[model samples]
Target: MLRSIATFLCLRCQPVTALPLNLRSRATHSVAENQQTVEALYDLSVDIQKVRKLKGWVLLQSPAYTKEVAELLKNMGASGPIIAHILTSHPEAVLCNPEQIYTQKELWISVCPNQRELVGIIEKFPASFFTSSSHHDNQRNNISYFQSLNLNKRVITKLMASAPQSFSRPVEHNELMVHTLQQAYQELGGEEANMKIWLQKLLSQNPFVLLKPPEVLKENFLFLRDKGFSTPQLLHLLSRLKGFVTELNPDSMRRTLLYSQDTIGCSETELRDIILRCPALLYYPESTLAERFEGLLSAGISMCQITETPTVLELTTQIVNYRIQRLKARGYDIRTGSLEVLNGTKKDFEMSFGKLQLRRERPLFNPVAPLKADD
Candidate 1:
């Protein structure tokens, strides 16, 4: 009996897929030859070993399958204590004789410690005592149903102690600590040394200090404009000084200095001194007429002509044409009827010119000019 048990135990250790069909056939033959009870017990032992190995949970569709698996465990000499643990961990494994415990597709999810407990349980039960029944639901409930569980202050204290470090500190204090750490690392002196780490940690810890680009720009514009600076100069100053200003200063001294110059009329000497001291206040030249002309060309205005001499009629016509072209390019709805009016005006001017010429051609009463040689 000892050798038979040892062999069965050894067989249990064998990979389930590697189990010889012949051995299975023999086991099946033994049960069938004996009775349904024996066969059920034999099959149960095999399944329990499989479950113990953590291969997967089995779904018992019928009472016979459950009883057979239980009986097999019993035959293997599985103990009550071990069985209790296994049943606790895998309550779903227990099934009524008419019900199945696992399905072919369902995963047999069991943790490692639970699996060990299950295996130990199977080796202590008696083969004959194992039976299929409808008590599986009760067994399933028993797994997580630990009686007399308590939640004491000590347990709560232990849980709090194990929590994340950030949870222990005031949020603002945490931010200060991060900022201090960053400033420390930055001061430590290597250009490539973990600067990003310290900086990011600092920023993330206190994100309130970060300013949006528009706000920064607006502040900058206000700053420079307040300092008696022109728009072009302010833009130039902003471009040059952007790299140095790392932190946003809501109460910036520089901003105050700027506001004083703009709002409070500073003495000429003070203003000059301020401009001289601030190198970023330097200005660029204004756009020239030539530049404006080039801009017009760049904007797709064609058929333009400019000359040193200017005539009222020519200038007026040029202005009108320029306005019309600009309006058309900008998607304005110009009517041909208006253009006809312009043509009619031009024709009238032509006719007026012809009449004036005809009047001049008409002989005056005493036309004065260089006397003819005959006179």
Candidate 2:
């Protein structure tokens, strides 16, 4: 078993199709009659030893169809190195029967525009394509259901590639979650025309939302409502979170809220206003928020400045320290300046820094002005 491990080192240079015609025909032989599954792996440059270690029981229980898997991938337009990499990365892919994989291909093709695109997805996410055959019915049903909803094909394809588990479960599971989201949107005053668009964007942003029990979403909504957030405000937060609201539970959210209010020395109304401006404060853990608060305070930033520019809290301690140092080096005192300059992604910070540098280096007086007489 260990000896076969040495063979995969050169697999990068060789393709399964490079095997001689006589050896290639053996792929059609029965698993029992053909004991060359290990040899097939070696020929394809797969790490047999690694596969044996990770999923040895698979080889012990039943023969792996490495050649068939390679053939299937080749027919789908995968290059030699891609095929080798996929098989190497996911050895259990060979355990799936050729017929099941064909059916999966057809199902994916129903949504994918062409084999080239499907091949690219398979290269990146081989497990999604080689999942258990038992989920075929559920996968088919869920694909049809999403299509019925008029969701764009690209979004459906993305969900299949990134979150196959969502499609493997019973169709009813997704239906319940979708219904909950729809009802919440309606209550939040979402219009009918925008319903499908909102749902599409939400699922595209976080397909795993479908895996959560519908009750979790309801409980979160109630918790936020109890915290004095109106329906429109809730919608704003949900949109801002990019549909990750399902990732939060009331306990964690309450803890984060308490930590924010206590550290900032803000009343409930003030904290609520801060949360509306920077929704992440409601989800970031106490440790993270505490570290950021300590960094800003130690830098001579006042609580009033922090409260006024809560978005700065989104930056990590290291980032805040680095940005403060950069601004200080440019003669800009963050202690006296608005903390708003620190509120944005990496690109935004670079733009702000560039503008600050220009202002500092710029000439205060006209260099070309006529010199006054010594008098």
Clashes per model (N, Cα, C within 3 A): 26, 0
Return the TM-score for each candidate structure: 0.16, 0.83
**How do the residues 1-375 of candidate 2 rate in per-residue lDDT, one tens digit apiece?**
666555433332232332354553434222322246666776787765565556443444355677898999999898888888888778778888999999999999999999999989998998999999999999999999999999999999999999999999999999999998999888888888999999999999998999998898889989999999998998888777756898999999999998888888889998889998998887888998888899999999999999989999989999999989888888899999999778799899999999888888889998798889896
TM-score, structure 1 vs. true? 0.16
lDDT of 1: 0.36
lDDT of 1 at 71: 43
lDDT of candidate 1 over 1-375, digit per residue (tens): 999778655544543434464565423222112234334434334343343345222321223344544543444455555544444344334443322323100111121123333344233322211222333333223212211122232222222222212222334443344344344334334243545543443333333222223344355445545646665554344333432223434355454445434532556456544443443222211222234334433434331121111111122335445544644544443332132212225555456445545665778755577656874
Runs in model 2 lying further than 4 Å from the true structure: 1-35, 59-61, 365-375
